[model samples]
Target: MLTSKQRSILRSMGNELEPILIVGKGGITANTIEQLDQALSARELVKGRVLPHTEWDTRETASELAEATGADVVQVIGRNILFYRPPETGRSPRIDLSGEG
Candidate 1:
């Protein structure tokens, strides 16, 4: 679980990141989850969007994506969703958050 401060830090970091994936008419699919997993593994932070025309709700889809990707929700602003996961094994996470105990 992420502390509020950690979520805040990730939000700030997310502000500068362009959405890497866009969920469209298909909603969340196996390919979408695959890309999310790859992105999270490589970058630790990932931002994605649900197109306005999509059938799925942004927040619900965000939750689904996070669970499928094994990532934590950083934030969801508008149609955008931000996800984060710690680096795997020896891979170093690029973003550091304070207030860790």
Candidate 2:
């Protein structure tokens, strides 16, 4: 679980990131989950966008994607969504959430 402070920090970091993952009218799929899993492993923080025509709303899409990829939802603004996950064992996470300056 992420603390409010951690989520805040991630939200700030997400503001500058461009959306790399896109959810379309197809909604969530196995391939989409796989891609997001790979992204989480590599980047820890990922930004995604849901097209306006999708069946699922932005918040629902974010929730499903986050659950599917085992990532935390950092924020969802408009069509953009931010996700964060710690790297697998033996790998280093890209974002630091220790709350130490």
Candidate 3:
């Protein structure tokens, strides 16, 4: 879980970041989840964009991705979803500004 302040901070930082991954007509898949896992390992926070043509609902996709990637849902705005996971070894702590914590 993330605190509101942390989520707010991440959201602000996320604003400048472009979506690194795009969900298309194929929708979320095992391969997609693997890629997302890799991405989360490298970057604690990642933004994913759901293509307009995607058949999956935004919330559903977000939930699936978050579950697969072991990440927390920071925010979902329009077709974009924000995901966060703290780094291993406790090197970098995930900051959540949503105040969910």
In model 1, which runs have C-alpha deviations exceeding 4 angstroms?
Answer: 99-101
| lDDT of candidate 3 over 63-86, digit per residue (tens) | 999987789899999999998888
Q: Relative to the true structure, how large is the alpha-carbon lDDT of every model?
A: 0.89, 0.90, 0.85
lDDT head-to-head 2 vs 3, winner = 2
Task: Report the candidate with higher lDDT, 1 versus 2.
Answer: 2
Model 2 lDDT tens row, 6-86 = 998888889999999999988899999999999888889999999986677999889989988889998988999999998
TM-score of 1: 0.93
Rank by TM-score (best first): 1, 2, 3
Whole-structure CA lDDT of model 1:
0.89
Stretches of candidate 3 exceeding 4 Å from the true structure: 90-101
What would the TM-score be for candidate 3 when compared with the true structure?
0.87
Candidate 2, 38: how far from true, in Å?
A: 0.5
Error of 3 at 90 (Å): 5.0
Model 1, residue 79: distance off in Å is 0.5
Task: Specify the highest-lDDT model's number.
Answer: 2
lDDT of 1 by residue, 1-101 (tens): 99898888889889999999889999888999999999998889999999997688999999999888779988988899999999887876677776452
TM-score of each: 0.93, 0.92, 0.87
